[model samples]
Target: MGANEALRVAFRTFGCKLNQVETETLAARFEVAGASIVGPDDGADLVVFNTCTVTSKAEQKARREMRLALRRNPDAVAAVTGCYAELDPEALAAVAPRTVVLPGSRKDALGGMAEALVAARLEGLDLLDELRRLAAAASGGLPDPFSFVPGEARFRSRVQLKVQDGCDNRCAYCRVCLARGRSVSLDPDEALRRATSLAAAGVPEIVLTGVNLSQYRSGGVGFPGLLELLVRGVPSAAFRVSSYEPDRADAAFMGAFSLPGVRPHLHLSAQSGSDRVLRAMGRRYGRDDVLRAAEAARSVRDDPFLGADIIVGFPGESDDDFRDTVGLLELMRPAWVHAFTFSPRPGTRAFDMKPRVPERVAVERAAVVQAIADRGKLEFARSRIGKTLVAVVEDGGDEAVLGDARRVFATSAEYLKLEVRGVPAGFHGSCACRVIGLSDGDGSADLVSIFI
Candidate 1:
């Protein structure tokens, strides 16, 4: 088959921010190949469904979305890709027998789906070599997926670059290493080149993502060093780092955020607050280590939002252990908490760990941490209620909100749900918002009064 510009394509992405970035790359590949990328409901000739398999819930959600995509475009060529597809292709093929299934290991080739569809349209044209060539050129050995910059109109509001991939930190609860292999860090020069391109494309924020971001190393330059160089080179774009382990946060390393372009946010995952739980989970850091890291980051900047991931209920967790977690969170008083109950996946040591926490007990523990989190979140937002911060207008109107550095949800640079109202057109570009009312401890934001 040959290329066709008239083809209408659509993408439905699932899972984390990394999945979203891959989905955008897929859309760009199709658009670059002369396909019109459309919304899921817009009736497509080809539809790509990106799946995630982090949790059982995520896997089930991906399956549901796959079926929905098939229904949405009855005539569209179906394709499934991402972690779920890689981890369980057979189950996926069972549901959608004719669907093109791609796994996370081959994510670099997602762009080829557009070519495959076009080649299918051509009469008697063999495209095996062409498809392989296209995939390799776009990704393959050194996949620069985020470097595909189309235009400002088609540009992603946020550009995500994978400076690192895979994980070697065999945390007892993780299946990512099996699916994504060992870690591989990106070269710094290439990373800088990609960030420059995204900035040139008018991407406002660039999120540096990885399965194990702290593990990034290339040519004697560590993740922090690479970040320093990128900040100096790509000053046009603000940079953000995804979830990292607290052990990697050191004085000199955390000091890199002093660069003006690096967003003053550190999303470090402290799986459990108890040292016992941390050892059982095989995580390298302890409660004190995480606290020290948080303190270091906060000390470097003006109240940079320090968010964390905490697993509430793990195997063999005691009441004191849970309380220990709450105590740590109270001490850190983080801007946000990504708290969830521990999930047991097969092929992990934790799967066979003794004395599993009962589902009911786990749920209750999650609630306890959640309440702690809610209070901390609200207080964090209220902390900035009077300070004027540079608010980047993400959208406008009743639901319109603004973001700033720290990049949580930021106008406070937090994920605080503050509803915006009466933002005049003059408030459009280069605007500043004074911290005003915060949400009422619910997901809904407070009624935005004015642009103080």
Candidate 2:
């Protein structure tokens, strides 16, 4: 690797849509530095894995990806960053010894390090050793994350627009707030500029994502205000927002649906339905609050795709508490639930809380919630049948028709997976299709062209 010779860099992201968008931002920066971004499957001179640590399983996956990157390309300079690095830098550093570990605190400086690493390799210096030393030398609390702008023409349809970063809520079971810091939103003007650029580049959809998406606040404009600006500035793009606490949602926020560009989907987090458990977990809202938010959202949009995150086994939770959670899900009838078994992270308030649920018990409780979730997903998918949905096609399949149908993969405005047929390949732009039925495959929806 030398200044004259272009370097190949590959990225593997494992977390939220925000992480994915950040990876794209990093890739764009690498390209600006004269590096070619390649897939992880391909051999590359350097690889980066943006990791997650919301759960033990997520951390395990991040460590595994770091190790796999090294195994796939033994000579590759591997770097790990994101939540896992921010939460547990030592663990990630120990995972792939000699690899560069950049904590979320130092992520902004990463763009400048790409060329430095390449230059070191060319100088016959040990790149990994030098990078790891540099990682250690850069210490102290990280400032607010640098504003990242995803490439204008990054995807065919959906482009994730990160309008916010960090969180303020210190929920007992969450380490994200400690790792991510206070909420800081993107500037509305800069956000609108990015949105307009994406629309001009032919992006059909833009997914607004962040650690605390609904908590976005910058220049006296909140998430809803920012959304209105994006919608008005980019008429060509449809927008979908990722998850936030249920109480963060209200009529004012959901009312943005009046704009056709704002998609009808709310990935809300209702950690636990039991008021006692919620109180213990330091959650700001109760079960009823979640229900009201859902109702208010529905009032704005007839039937939006409502999904939630439900943590099952927090400390001091009794059977009645667990039952209350399940009951609430049954009553709310959300489109789906992201069921996560409690993983006690060190330094979190809940870590030392008494009467911790046994691991086996927590696993069983998670299964119960997931069963309800599975049924909810099926019912939601079935609802799409016989209705026309405006959707954008993804390019996972070749442009060829099978029989009388073209099995084009797509996603509806509400973030539902769709297998669209009868739409021409040349029709690469967004299109309206009538959902014919559900595929046997999980999360699969079948759609046909509405027009002859």
Candidate 3:
């Protein structure tokens, strides 16, 4: 490829924030390799599809995108990588005959992959083996040094940084551990260095994300120790942690939120609220532990936007179990509920368990749980109606503006209108907004004005 060949490339990512950060890192590598990044419609010479197989739906979506990419650029070299590719290489290869499947481990060697593709050597088995082997060899080396790059993020106002990778938990319903492999924490000094760069880039917020973030430990620095350093070391940007296990929600974790730069929102994964169901799902903690964690967070910060991920209709889940979950939600009244219908993953233990709930029953239970979740969110938002919230101005359009400016807003989609009475001006990017009225629907808010 000539230096001015203008090797246009496009990427589509699916799944969590860690995937996003990895994609960005890949894009950076591509740019360094002299590729011009472009949109999907630009008819790029190369297309990279980052796949996610967290759910059956996610797998289907990834396959659909792969096919679309093939159709969009039939002659263009198509590369597939991510958790889905790592878990099932054959499935990804079947998406397109010309598709080159790259294992997740090979993500760091993407610059070499790009070079091989440009030379049309991305065609045969030998090339694929070489790519895989190169990735395997590189995996043993220390993480390639990375610095946060500044630009307008396509998806959100805030950017996520992967301080660590992989998971140690074997939750019966989760396949992440299998896809990501064993838990491996990034070096603490490198993590802090990256955080400092992100802060320098004027990223207002940086969410620390990973498969099992609580298990992060490097150089005797635990998650909390790293969190303290990030908060104290990089005060220019707000910090947030992604989904965490309930057992990891200890006093030290709670104290991290007390830091001024730390976001008060906490997303704890409480898959079930019944002790029997928890044991069946192989969860480490019981329902009571979840409740206590919620209480502790509330104690630290009044009405913190606490969130939970609840799975309904797991194998052998009974009516009493469902009611117990409802009771727990009623008691804790989390800011929001991420209700998921139990879909048995291929390799998970839950897939083979007996007493499976019917598909219709699972759907019904999910709906019921969602109704309860809706009420909890409404109550949480109502509680903040008269309170002033630090609103991060996400998108300032003609009709509305939104963001996670403070702990008062229950939902990230909770946006305030610019036309509302008593609303102030210049609330375009990460400004505080006073809550005037609740939105008609529970999903958003009605702000009177932006507070300077």
- Which portions of model 2 show Cα errors greater than 4 Å? 1-5, 116-126, 129-144, 402-405, 442-452
- Once superposed on the true structure, which residue ranges of model 1 sit more than 4 Å away at CA? 1-5, 119-153, 395-430, 439-452
Per-prediction backbone clash count: 5, 0, 9
Cα lDDT of model 2 overall? Answer: 0.80
Among all windows of 10 consecutive residues in model 1, the one with the lowest summed lDDT is 404-413
lDDT of 3 by residue, 1-452 (tens): 33336567898999887778878867766666556788766777678888887888999999988788768777666778888887898988887776777666555556555555433332333433444555556556543323323232333456677777777778888887887787887787887887787677666777788788889988998898889889899988788878777888899888876677777788888988899999999999998889988888888875677789999889999999988988888887876788888888999999899899888988898898788877776676666676666655554434323442322232232322322332234433355555666665543454334354
User: How much does candidate 2 score in TM-score?
Assistant: 0.92
Q: Looking at model 3, report the run of 10 residues with the lowest lDDT sum.
A: 410-419
TM-score of each prediction: 0.86, 0.92, 0.84
In order, candidate lDDTs are 0.71, 0.80, 0.72
Most TM-score-accurate candidate: 2
Which candidate achieves the best lDDT against the true structure? 2
Q: Choose 2 or 3, whichever is better by TM-score.
A: 2
